[model samples]
Each structure stands twice: as structure tokens, then as C-alpha cells.
Target chain A: MVKHCSVFRDKTELEQGVAKMAELRQRFKKVVLKDRTDYYNTELPSVLELGNMLDIAYSTLIGALAREESRGAHTRTDFPKRNDEKWMQHTLVTKKDDTFSLSYKDVSFTKYEPTERKY
Target chain B: MKIDLKIRRFNPTTKNGREPYYQAYSIEASEGMTVLEALMSIAAAQDPTLSFRRSCRSSICGSCAIKINGFTKLACSTQIIPEHEKAHEMVLEPIANHTVLKDLIVDFDPFWKKLDKVKPYLMPPETQPEGRTKEVHISEKDAEAIDHAQKCIMCGSCNSECNALEIEKKYLGPAALAKAWRFVGDVREEGGRKRLGRLSDDHGIWDCVRCVHCVEYCPKGVEPLTAIERLRSRAIQEGIKDNHGAKHVEAMVNSVKKVGRLDEAAMTFKTLGLLRSLGMIPFGLKMEMHGKMPHPHLFPQIKKIDEVRTIYAEIKRKNKNAKKKPKG
Candidate 1:
């Protein structure tokens, strides 16, 4: 989960991330609080923090999987070129259960026209 | 690398004043590990009860501002290694001038209340500038100034270090005044006059001591002290001079111009007039008794009074030139 990031990774690493997520889910049991009302009753990490990290990691990997173009920091060897016609807009992804759904929002341009990057 | 941490702990739900104490821990910190990450590591490994507010892990949330080595800063952005001074020990405490709710969490009620006073929102003009169909047009220059103030993340670093707020709890503090600048500097806001008027009142912009601590401590480089000063000058420019702060400053400037140095006696007379100046006699006598107010001889005539005047003139000219330039 910690090794997963969108930048400069290809299909193999992303697939490994998806599999890693499932493996972690199977290996790590959910923590239960001894006293629900007492914030300090738990062990080192409260269940809430682990839960947030699980959700964040899941969503991040899912978002990376849904994107197919190389734009900004998202470098995908599988989709080396930016498909501007289809991928010019933002990729909005949502996860329900294990399924990922995607949508797009148009980029609003003002004043200067979008130019090719040199750097 | 192994680093030592001394974290100040205060649990308001259980402890009171003087009960707060520091707890030491050792953590293995890697390269590029932030102070926030270090704290998280300690909490995850050594202590579950350790408390601090955090969100976004990134600096945007503005939740993890704490005093590290007596300076208020965002924990998320402050790298641990660069801050090491005493071998590997780092002292962490809740920010000053705010009530500590727990270990490192502070009650932000006062901070929020002060910000609420600024009406930190736009009150648009009744009629749009270009016409009904078009959105209000703010020249790039004006928008740039507003954008600078908009960088404030309300991290409370400025508030924690504000000397003015230390003395006057009611002083709007840096974050709120900077927020006020966003609205006052906005060309679309019709209530610029009204907003400036409120800020000109007591415990407002004038209350800031210009210590520049806010500017130094602001992570966003908002330069809140500069914003408060602009608010003061703007108020005077708008002919809203019903403030003692404005009067005191104008009197000081005029006095300096006339005498080539501060004529405190004359300045006070002009600032408060004869009656109010007379009312200050008791305080003046106390100062005299303490030998703090040595009898003043005419300050030796400045060697280059003309140069002083020329510098002032140059500043005025530069200000006029800046006003004439097209803002981007």
C-alpha cells in the first residue's frame, strides 16, 4: 500500500498494487476497540486511522487504474501518449464495492490557449 | 537516524494548568520524514494516546501547526532532520496563546470567532461592472493582490506568534486581518469602505503592533503585517480618519518632518490634542520619575535634513508611479 503511487509506474506495478491491496486485506484483521467511547482504550493505532488509510489506498489505486493516459505526473508505459481528444478533461472515479466507475469534466480554458510543454 | 522527541502533553478533559508536561520518545526517522510523520510514527508504535489534529497529510489542511523549538509551524511541511539542533532532540508543544484542548490540539474557538468578525466574504456590487450578462471584470493586477492574500491557509502560525494578540486578546490577529485584506483589496466588493471602517475601529487593524512576527511565521508568505498596514493606509486614504491609530501615525510623521526627528511631546499633543495630552500627565510624571523621559534638548539638527525629505519625496513618487501601472 505504501509503495503504490500514480507517478512513473507502468501496468505491471499497478497490477501488483491491486493484488497487494487484496493480499493486505486478507492478512490484516480489522481492529476492535475494547471500549468504544474511550478514545485511549485501544492499542498503538486506533482502528479509525487504519480504516482511513485502507480507504485512501484503495481509492488511489482505483483512480490510477481508471486513467489510461500519460498526463501531469501520471506516467503510464501502457498508454505512453496523451489521448487529448478523450482525456483532455479530468477523470472522476468512484468506487462502490470492488467496481470502479469513471466520469469526466471538461477543462475550462480562459485567456491563454493550452500550449505544448517543453519542460 | 535515531531522533529524540520531547512532546508537551496537556489533556483538558482531565488535566489543568501546571499539569501539562513533556513526554520523551525515541524514533527512527528516515530522510525526508516530516515532523508530522515522526509524530505519527511514535503514535503508531509507542503510544496510541498521543493526540494531535491532522488531515490531508499535505500542508493544505492547516491542522498540524504546533510549536517546534519555540516557533509555530506546520508539522506536515517541517522536515525533522533539518530542525535537529541538540544532537537529535526536538521539543514539540502546542502553539501559544490558544487553549490546549489535549496533547497538541488547541481550542480554536477564539481564532474562528475573530475570523468571523472580518465578514470574510465578498459583498458584490448591486450592478455588475461590464453589464448584466458579463461577470465582474477585475484587472489582473487587482486579482493578483487578492490572490496573494488568498494563500493564507488559516494555519494559526501567525496568530500563535502575534505580539499584539498577546497583549490584546480582542485584537483581530493576523489571520483575520489578512482575510479582511482579501475583501478590502477586491474590486468587486462594494463594501470596501464599510469593511475598512470596521477594521479601523479599536481592536482592529490599528491594534497590530507591526512586530512582523506574523510575516515571519506565515507559511504561505501572506505577510499579514503588511496587509494590516495597507488596511490602515487605505482607511486614511478613504478619509475615514476617526481612529486614534491613524491620528497617532499622522502626527508622528508630521512631527518627524518638522523636526527631522520624533518630537514625542508635540506628536502626543497633536495626536490627542491639549485636553487628552493633559490627561496623560500622571503617566508622563511616572516616566519622568523613572528617568526614562530625560529632558530633551532640540535634537541636533540632522546633518542631511534635505536628504531625509528627498527620500520621503522619492517614496511618495514611487507610490504614485506604482498606482499608475496596469496591474496584471
Candidate 2:
């Protein structure tokens, strides 16, 4: 008999996520209120905690970085342009040995291909 | 700009044996006027008998869902300015996968029946302390997961867009499965075993083709595809194996894991097992006749086997790590 583990195990990770979000809110509030934009620049343990809080943030960041286009929710202010050639495939982010890596997955092109992503 | 609103109209009383027809109503473009509002204006001014369902003009209540420009959307929520302009016309019709009642309304009996079959309710444990009431402590992370599940309003949008529903009407579509997962993930619910049993049947959980149309059409961020995947994983965990689907999935996964790619013939043979009397030979022969079965000799030949193995290993590792953490 092939044994499968519980999918409800994600509940635990969700708990850790909430604690991180609360901490980020506080950090963001303090920085904005004190007019200290360099608050994140300061070396602190909270930065690590914030990183842990935004666990899924790496996926979005990597996806944004990989795609030089502002399509859907993926927007890169730095690139300021859409590059369809290099980033036409869907950016898949999977955690490998406690580190997140990016992979490209093929997308089915039916009716529309990637064009200039106008709102 | 004048936009042609092609509305499907069907009056049960006046329209005898005639098929449903699309009546064009040209309306002036108004700022911030939703498709539902434009529909209401057409109904009020041009045709009062233009039948469609609408209660709350807001996205909530899940009513007023219709197909606009080949996509399922809440007419009340969708702004009709630019999207319709790009298309040059708006086609309003009832949600798919259900019987059309009249014009833009569909009979929701099938949707409700599937919802009821899943037994959408919390079945708490019998061992509760008497006279000592305590709030069920849910972490924010778990709460967020539940929050994702909670956003579903039983709108048949997901069902309408579900490819599984198109092929197999008996298969409980995404909305119902997501509801089942909502109950399954509830920490206070002690009926997980029963729930799993109910979903382990042929037309139940095992029937999802994973086409992911439900994931796209859902107005809320509820990914029913993920929920269904989670359910499948849970069902496997609980040792409840349906006839061939479970075995097929397992064989496919194992084949991919072992050889780093799918050995279609080997996977089929593994799934069929050594029992000749199990009626698998005929099935294999049929598939062979249909040219669906690949040759058995070319079993382990695949490009980038190591890369595939590495990807699978990484996914398994992440899943293992994710399970070890506590609920938020």
C-alpha cells in the first residue's frame, strides 16, 4: 500500500506566516511614521523574521525578476519593459533543500500569444 | 460610444416552440456603469420582460453570474467600459453545465445537489468537556488557508468553467470539492475519515481531470484545483484506493520518480499488475488497437532524466518540510 501524507499539514506553515505578517506591519508602520526609510537598511534580527513572514514573497520576486514584463500582478519597476523572448514560459518556483530555485514551465498558446501587456 | 448588447431572451409563455434568440439593444456608454447596471437599464427602458437574476448589485451574494464575451463573470462586478469596447459587443447568457431556465437564468438544482452530497458542515468530536466552552484556536496562517476556502459563494462560475463538468456531469466540480476541503481542513471537525470516504468514490474526488478552468474562472482567489490535489493526497494518506485511478496515479508517479520520466508501457503494465484474470489484457489490447499504447521495449528512454528526477526530489522535499511546520 502506497502511503500518502496529509495535505492539512499546510496549516502549520500558515500559523508561522501570520506571526511574520504582524511583525512586518509593525516594522512598516514604524518606518513610515518616523520618516526613516533606511529602517530596513539597519542590520536587525527582524529582517530575518520579515523574510520568514514573506515566505511566498520569493516566488513573486523571482517571477518578477525572471519576467521583464508587467503582466498581470508581475510588475518590475527596474526593467520598465516587457521581454517576451526570455520569459514567455511560466516561472515555476519550488523550494529545494531550504532554498528556493526558479524553473521555466511551458505554457499552452491557444488564442493569444504574449504581446505588449497593456492594461 | 454605442455598444451592441446581444442578450439571449426566452419567454416561456409567449415564445412557443421557437428557439431562444438574441435581441440587440444599443446603449449609450456611461461612466462606471457595470454590465449588470446596463442590463437593468435595458430591462427598464427597452424591455421589462427581459428576464435575468440580480439581487445585490455588489459582487457578494454570488447571484447575477453570467457569461460575458465567452468568459464567466459576475455581471454586477464586471465594469462594461473597456472590455466590451475591445470586443465591440457583449454576449449575455446563462451559466453553462446547467439547464437554462429562461434567458440569463439557469436551474441551480444540480449545483445544490452536489453541494449537499459533500455534506458541507462541521462534525465536531463527541468528546467535548461539559459546561467548559472554549474558542477554537486557529492560527493566522491556517486562518488564511481557511479564508481562501471561505471566499467561495457557491457561485456556479467555477462549475460553468469546469472542463470536468463538461465531460462528466456526475463528477462533483471544484466548488463542491473546495467546500469539502474547507470542512476537511477544519481542525475542529472530527469527521475527516467520513468525509474522505464520501469523496473516494468513482464520480466523486477521483474524477477531476485537473484541467484548471475552475482555477481561472473563480472570481475569488480560491484555487479549487489545489484543493482537489490536496484531497487526492489526503485520500492516498487514508489508504482509501479507488479501482484503477489511484493505482494509475501511483504508477505514473512512481514511474516518473524511478526512471526520471514516464515509461508509458511500463506504467501501464505496473498499473495492470500480473493478474491476467483481472480483465486488464482486453483493456490493453483495446488501447493497443487504438494506437494509444507505446511499445514496451522503449521503456526507460527519455531526455533530461536527471533534471526530471531532481525536480521531483525538490518538490517532495518542499512538501515534507511544509508538513512539519505548525498551523499559523
Best by TM-score: 1
Candidate 2 residue runs with Cα over 4 Å from true position: A1-119, B16-18, B129-134, B270-292, B301-328
lDDT by residue (tens digit), candidate 2, B1-328? 6778888866554534147888889888687889998987886567655667777898788988899988899998888987687776799888899888777878999899999999999888787745547767787766675667778987789999988899899999899999998988787777888889889887888888888888898888788988888788788777877556677788888887776667777666666566743567777778889987677566754777778889888998998898797532
Clash pairs, model 2 backbone: A11-B327, A12-B326, A12-B327, A14-B141, A14-B328, A15-B327, A15-B328, B139-B328, B140-B328
> Model 2: how far is A100 from its true place, Å?
71
What TM-score does chain B of candidate 1 reach? 0.87
What is the Cα-based lDDT of residue B229 in candidate 1?
A: 83
Model 2 chain A worst lDDT window (10 residues) = A1-10
- What digit string (tens of lDDT, one per residue) describes model 1 on residues B1-328? 8988999976544534238989999999899999999998887778767888888788898999999988999999999998884335699999988988778888899999999999989998776555357665677777887776899888899999999888888889999999999899887778989888888888998888889999998888999987888788889878888767888888877766665788777677777878998999999999989976534365565677888888889998998998897432
Local error of candidate 1 at residue B280 (angstroms):
2.8
Docking class of 1: incorrect
Return the interface RMSD of the candidates, in order shown, one decimal each.
5.0, 28.5
The residue pairs that clash in candidate 1, if any, are B140-B328, B141-B327, B141-B328
Q: How good is model 1 by TM-score?
A: 0.76
Local lDDT at B212 for model 1: 91
